[model samples]
Target: MTVELRVLPPLLVSLAVTVVLAACTRVPPPPPPESREGFPERGARLIQQYGCGGCHTVPRVPRAEGLVGPPLTRFGARSYIAGELPNNAENLRRWIQDPQSVEPGTAMPDLGVSETDARDIAAYLFTLE
Candidate 1:
């Protein structure tokens, strides 16, 4: 005995292909660049990638209303770093490079930000004024 398989109609096949092609043709929107001084576009990307908003409140980044850590809105204007070290670029760099070194047992961990990224993040944080 011989068996025959039914084939889908050509019109249905073409319509399915058209629907798939249209779905695949979608384009994603480009990221918005940070226009603030010191906080370059790259730094903003890094901040989002590093999950900074998971713990701290970062301006402009949506869903960054976390309160696990201190609000960074006034980090630049703060008089002291970690409530002990003086606030400055150098000190901020040190803190970002290794938070545990500056304050052992602190809940904050160093996210391994490079010197350049640290400066940019700090610049953005400072602009929170």
Candidate 2:
């Protein structure tokens, strides 16, 4: 009597299906976009409109060329404002509203950002990191 062994093929196929299903089940969806609660798209537009990037190396703005001010690539992650005030949205807004008030000798000018604009700019800046 001769016995045929067809069991190995089915076992291999079952194992492959199990592996594929496992792989598919384990994958996670991508994370959602960062919150823009305080940051509005208009603020990003204003950043360009006001030419803030000309003096500061603002992220995501193009044609920005000026060496007058400090680079602001990581301004959001900074711990202090002008090396004095605590790094917070309110402080950033105040600084933007009036830089000289924060630091008497600082060369950063007041861009005439309104309360709303300042908030938006601060929100955008906070997203740098």
Candidate 3:
């Protein structure tokens, strides 16, 4: 029992010293801040990529001042889209993805935009308000 007690204290002290050394050696990095969802940024890129500016005169989009179609400056505040469908997210995405499906004789062409891209573009356009 006497032999065991002498050795146990040393072992415990060594273990504690090792733990302290490890703690002092390197500092843990601070937790990263939650990144903002890249919704607006991604939406703007998609809008420009699909050439929406070709017809619609969208504000905040460089060189998007086309006069062929209706100006989408305050699209979010608008009650209707193309004077046909409601201006909600789902409707906006549907219109962007496939305009012909929404309106038979509409001038807006189906730009073949993906569902995700359409959603993102709509999210960005909504920010106009």
Candidate 4:
């Protein structure tokens, strides 16, 4: 075989590797529009209404541009909440409903989020992943 033919196999392998890597690192798309009263959508609305954006930078939430607290750009992927509690749906809900209970000196105050609203808010936060 000629030199070009000898290099074809390696070139093809490299191209395949690049394609696989690209696919692996691909970013997830945005969630679809609110569907039949989904908690995530409801939670998003509640977040805005409750002025959550006044403190934290929630991704994709309208007017969620506050800089008082930590930015929630990829909150679902975080390992901990409030830099203490493990990052989980239950923990998120608990923290949302009552921050002072979790961390006495925490800047995040108890916003009086009801259990249902807390659940919905957590659901929406997890969607950021």
Task: Report the number of the highest-TM-score candidate.
Answer: 4
What would the TM-score be for candidate 1 when compared with the true structure?
Answer: 0.64
- List per-prediction Cα lDDT, in the order shown: 0.70, 0.76, 0.78, 0.82
Residue-wise C-alpha lDDT for candidate 1, range 1-129, written one tens digit per residue: 122223446667889999999999957533222223346456556677778889888877666777988877756566666876766667766787789999998888888888888877766665554
Could you give the candidate ranking by lDDT, starting with the highest? 4, 3, 2, 1
Q: Which scores higher on lDDT, 2 or 3?
A: 3
The model with the greater TM-score, 2 or 3, is: 3
RMSD of 2: 10.1
lDDT of 2 at 73: 74
lDDT of 1: 0.70
My TM-score estimates for the predictions, one after another, are 0.64, 0.67, 0.68, 0.69
Q: Model 4 Cα displacement at 104 (Å)?
A: 0.7
Regions of model 4 farther than 4 Å from truth = 1-38
For candidate 4, the TM-score is: 0.69
Q: Kindly list the per-residue Cα lDDT of model 2 for residues 15-122, writing each as its tens digit.
A: 999999998895553332233447656767778888887788787777655678877776666777788787787777889899999899788888798988888877
Clash number by candidate, in order: 0, 0, 0, 0
Candidate 1: regions farther than 4 A off: 1-38
lDDT of 3 by residue, 67-110 (tens): 88989887767767777776778777888888888888788888
- Give the candidates in order of TM-score, highest first: 4, 3, 2, 1
